[model samples]
Target chain A: MKAITVTNPDDPSSLELTEVDTPQLRDGEVLVKVHATSVNRADLLQAKGNYPPPKGASEIIGLECAGVIEDPGTTGRTTGEEVACLLSGGGYAEYVAVPEGQLLPIPEGYSLSEAAAVVEVACTVWSNLGMLAGVREGQTVLLHGGAGGIGTFAIQLCKQLGATVAVTAGSAEKLETCRKLGADILINYKEQDFAEELTGRCDVILDIMGAKYLEQNLKSLNVDGQLVIIGMQGGRKAEINLGALLPRRLSVRGTTLRARSVESKAEVVRSTVENVWPLLDDGRVTHHIHTTLPLADAAKAHALLDSGEVTGKIVLEVGEV
Target chain B: MKAITVTNPDDPSSLELTEVDTPQLRDGEVLVKVHATSVNRADLLQAKGNYPPPKGASEIIGLECAGVIEDPGTTGRTTGEEVACLLSGGGYAEYVAVPEGQLLPIPEGYSLSEAAAVVEVACTVWSNLGMLAGVREGQTVLLHGGAGGIGTFAIQLCKQLGATVAVTAGSAEKLETCRKLGADILINYKEQDFAEELTGRCDVILDIMGAKYLEQNLKSLNVDGQLVIIGMQGGRKAEINLGALLPRRLSVRGTTLRARSVESKAEVVRSTVENVWPLLDDGRVTHHIHTTLPLADAAKAHALLDSGEVTGKIVLEVGEV
Candidate 1:
């Protein structure tokens, strides 16, 4: 089987396409013949040696993929079923072994490429913002990096949950894209100061840039508001004012889904299948695909993501099984 | 009527016992002839001008008191009811007008002085740790300043709720008192590093010294742990590593009950009356009153709290009605 491997953790350019033996199925696992896989910021971090895959997971790049079941392994399902798998690693490969619990049936009416884009972002947004932050109906949400993969999906999910969605993106084009995706408020971060323009407080602030926006994010929160931080693209450390957080009864939470335990991942996947997959099937939520590259050109895919020009998910279309 | 007034917000000795007009009751208000008022850390902050009474509350120092109702105001309850009122302010005076909703009947076996100690700490711990943090049975909790008023109450309440309680205090004497209050693990913060000495992670960290323990507190939490900070005895600002918080799925929340709105306060009071008062009634929870000073000796009471020698709560006993 062909796969994208990180030979050295230096930069995205280090990603190489190489031939590797298909992964062996383990108990409670399935062998997925990858149709398409999506790139996440976490993959960039992993490639740069900043992040490591969970223990006993494949050291390949992708975190999510849409594929077909070659063998059900220990999972109760039969072979040759359509599925999308949330992976700790190995999604960069043609055939990856995954725990059955991490695999979701491709929702009706969604293609494999679209499902590939939907799985990682939807799961990430739902687990971090909806479940952890307890973002409720009629509450306002502030999404940072609003035109990116996670931010795009977060805008849709928050809107579906009856929240007023506000987004911050770098350019007018990205801001317009977010607006068309049902964002109630869009701030071109290059031109406007989000903290100043946002007069009212938000119930939840889903942040991708960590330390850079820490102070301003806290300032933008309402009393008892929550700031759910999923990424630290800006920097790692910042001065936190404990006194400021007290009067407003604010909470700051940081989370990542890729490195979580299998049980935890299974729980998130189960919840997503129950709540979000239906929304996708009913056309209430849609996946935004930026572009697709051949599996051999995973390098170009990563470059597109690194360039920051891609509005939504960037996928690698592995050869059809 | 006589009351202790803060003539200036600088010195603790500025608290002066002076004759003032007795408070008049309003609709749905009760006039309580003050029997005893407890000193909280907030009182010290109020005295030092670091904390101020919430808007619409009297510009007085006291937060909780136990006394007989001289008049139930227009609510039509008979006079002379033994009650403990969670006051917004004015409890330092000879007479304080309390909302009917804020008054709770004194537990059958508890005396006025003990009940005075109970109100402030009970309301503080229950609202922050219990209601907000959702502290559950069998989880580990770390309570900072565990011999102080809120700490002592937190230790007892966490124990009663079937949690394993670890407490950090300044001295051996304070640790001993924390043990007496049912703390399972006692760490002398002066001698031991709580983050290092604690072998297991805490499910909830009830912090009073905010910035001082921020880093160590984040390290001490288990996955999905909650750090509930109620005071900033430590400096207010410090460097926070949001990266450290992400993988653990931890939440850091800062809350203060005094500055909360009346509706919010009433909600807290209602929750306490429903969930915690029964424990007080059944003698499952007990209050520890360190000492009592005459109303004129409020400065002395402040001195005691400021000196940090007193364990449990200090009360200021006003004259008879």
Candidate 2:
């Protein structure tokens, strides 16, 4: 199996395509021939030694992949079924072993590359916004970095749940993209103060920037508002005035999907298939693929993401199995 | 009307008993001849000018009072009925005006001083723990400052709700008191590291010390744990690592009962009347009053509270109205 392996974590360029043995199947696992994978910010962090794969997970680089199941383990499902797997690691490989529970049948009418984008974004959005934050209809939600991968998916999901979506982006072009994707309000963070431009408080603030927007993000919340922080593109430390949080009954919750336990991840996958897959199958929610690069051009994909020019998910097509 | 006023933000000695005009009642308000009033930590903050009364509320001390309704304007409740009222301010005086909706009828056998203690703590605990956090039976709950007014009530209420209650206090004496109040586990924080000593994770952690316990409190949480912070006794600045929170799906919420809107407070009062009042009436819950000082001795009461010697609520007893 040819995989993107990290020999050292010093630099992003350290990611090497090396021939490695195929992973052996565990009791509840399935082997899949990788078709495609996507780049997430966490991938960059892992490349730079800032983040590591969860204990006992594969040392390979991908967090998600769409592939054909080679072995469904004890499950009676036939081989070569189209599926997407939420991997702890090893998604950037020719073949990977995934927990059968974390594997979802590719949605009807969607190709394998499209499903690659779905697993990561669906699992992330469903767990954070839908399950953790309890986002409901008629509520107001603010998505920071709204034109980015997670933000785009979060906007669509919140909109599907009947929420009024507000977004903060760095450029007018990004803001326009978010608006086209059902964002009701857009704040160009480069030009406008989101804390001031936002007229009323939001019921939920999904933040990617950590410290730089902490105070203003808190100020933007309504009573009993929930702040779900999934990324820290900004600095990490901030002077938090708990006095400010108390008066509004605000909650600050920080989470990342990468390190969750297998059982927890299985639950997220199950719930996502049950609740969100229907929307995808019905064409109510669509995946916004920014650009697809051939798997060998992985460096180009990384460079594109590094430049921050991509509006949505960047997929790496691994060729037909 | 005689009331306790803070002439300056300093020590308890700065509290002065001064004669002020009785507050006038407005539409949807009730004027009560305050028979008893209880001191909360917020009142101490107000005394030190760290916390100010909400806008349009009296610039006086005291957050809750129990007395006979001298007049109920516009709303049709009988005058002279014994009631407990949640006030934004003005409970220190001979008379206080409160919204008709904020008044709850005194339970049959509870005294005015007992009701005074019940109003603030009951409203605070029931709203934050039960209503907001949705703490259920068989769940573990950690109560910080577990011998104080809110703690006493929380220990009882959480026990009544069938939760296993763990508490942290400063002394063996306070821990003993909490045990009698139905706290199942007690950690003398002065002697032990609560985060290290707590072998089991809690479903809900009711925290009073904000930044001081942020990291450890998060460590003490189980998957999907809720950390409700209501005070900032340990200072407000802390380095929050969001990465630590995501895998466990933990939520850190800070809330204050005072300065909330009338509608929200009314909802809390109504909830207490419905859910908690039965427990109080049935003796399943006990209001722990540490000491009652004369209205003129409010300075002494504040001084005693400042010393942190009082185990539970401190009430100010006004003379016969």
Candidate 3:
């Protein structure tokens, strides 16, 4: 099987297309022929020797992919079924083994490439906003990185949940993209303080710039508000005033999907499929793919994502149908 | 009516029993003839002009009291109904107006003074551990100040919930008290590091030492653990490693019951009565009062709690039932 392997971990851009052994099907797992895989920030960290796969998971670099079952393994399932998979690792390969629970039926009309782009963002957003925060109607949700993959998806979902959506991005174009996706309030973080603009108004905040926005995120929340931090792009440590939280009944939570146990990922996949798949199928929520590249240009894909100009997901096509 | 008033803003011990206007009941409220009120740490802060009552709440100091209804204004309830009330303020008076939603039935086989001691602690512990943390059987809960008011009650509730309870206190005697209350693990904070002993083990931590235990509390939790900070006894600011929270999926929440609105308090009161009242009725949970004092000795009650020599609660008897 062909896979994207790190040639030099010290250099994050040293991803190379190389031959690797095909993944063996573990019990209750099925071998899938990966058609497309998408780049995630975690993949960038893994390449730089910062992030490591969870125990008993693949050492490969992708977190999500769209693929077709090649071998059903010990689980009783039909072979040749097309599916979108949430993976711990191994998606950056021609062949990947997926636990049965991590598989989702590709949304009604989605191509494999589009399906790949939706898996991580869909599961990530829904798990945090829907499962953890229990975002509901009449609530105000603040989304950071508004035009990015997760943010774009979340904006639409929050709107569907009957919430007022506020978004923060670095530029006008990104903010405009968020507005088009039904964001009610847009703040260019480069010029305005989001906390000041939305002070004590947000019911839930989907934060990616961990420590950098920690205080501001705390300040931006209303009474009984929740701040869910999924990524730490800005840094990782900050001073917190627990005093600020008590009277307001505020909460701060940090979560990562990849490090979760297989059972947990299964639960997330099940929920996303149950709740989010219908929206995708109905076109109420749409995938935002910034660009698509052939799997052989693995190094170039990493560089493009590193530049940070991409508005949404960058998909890598691994195989033809 | 007679109430305890702060004689000097600068002096925390300047509590004086004096004649005051009887509280007039608002719509959907009830006026109660206070029989017994229990001293809370918040009362100490309120006396020093630190913890002010919530908006529209009484300006007097006291959070929980057990009394009989004198007037059931607009609420259409029977006058003279014996109730345990969760109050925002004015519990130190001979009469206090309470929102009908915050009233609780006196626990079976309990005296008015005993019922007063259980209100604040039961509601605080249940709201945090039961509603917020969703603590269940097979989980491990860590209670700080284990022999104190909240801790002693929480220890028994956790045991009844079939959870393993760990506690931290300052002395051997306190730890012994916690053990007698069904705590499985005990750490004397003066001699041992609680985080070191319980590292990566706690599923839920009921914290009072805020900023002081913030880092250690984070370190002591297992994956998907929750730390509910109900008090800031140890201070309120601390540097948090957001990195530590992400992969482990930890949450930190701060809450104060006095600050909640009537509707929210109603929900909590309803839930507590439905779930916890049964425990009290069945003798599965019991109130632990350290001492009883005359209502005029309110100043002395606050002083006793502030001295850190008291365990459980100090009940201030305001009138004969």
Candidate 3 - CAPRI tier?
high
lDDT of 3 by residue, A1-321 (tens): 889999886787888888899998889999999999999988888998888888998999999999889999998878999989999999889999999999999998999999999999999999999999999999999999999989989999999999999999999999999999999999999999999999999999999999999999999999999999999998999999999999899999999999889899999989999999999999999999999999888789888888878788999998642
Q: lDDT at A147 for candidate 2?
A: 93
Cα lDDT tens digits, model 2, B209-280, are 999998899889987789999999998888787766766778889888886898889999999899999999
Worst 10 residues of 2 chain B by lDDT: B6-15
When sorted by DockQ, best at the front, the candidate numbers are: 3, 1, 2
TM-score of 3: 0.97
Compose the digit string of candidate 1's lDDT tens values, residues A71-188. 8887788788999999999998889999988999898898898889989998998898767887889899999988999888888999899999999998999999999899999898
Recovered share of real interface contacts in candidate 1: 0.97
In the range A1-321, model 2's lDDT, one tens digit per residue, is 888766665557666677899999888888899999999888887777777789989988889999898988877666988889999998888999998779897987999999998789989989888988889999999999899988888888999999999999889999999999999999998889998976447999988888888889988898889898888788777777777788889999988787788888899999999999998998888898999987776767777888988899999888842
Clashes of each: 0, 1, 0
Looking at model 2, the pairs that clash are A255-B246
Q: How much is the lDDT of residue B292 in candidate 3?
A: 99
Could you tell me the TM-score of candidate 2? 0.93
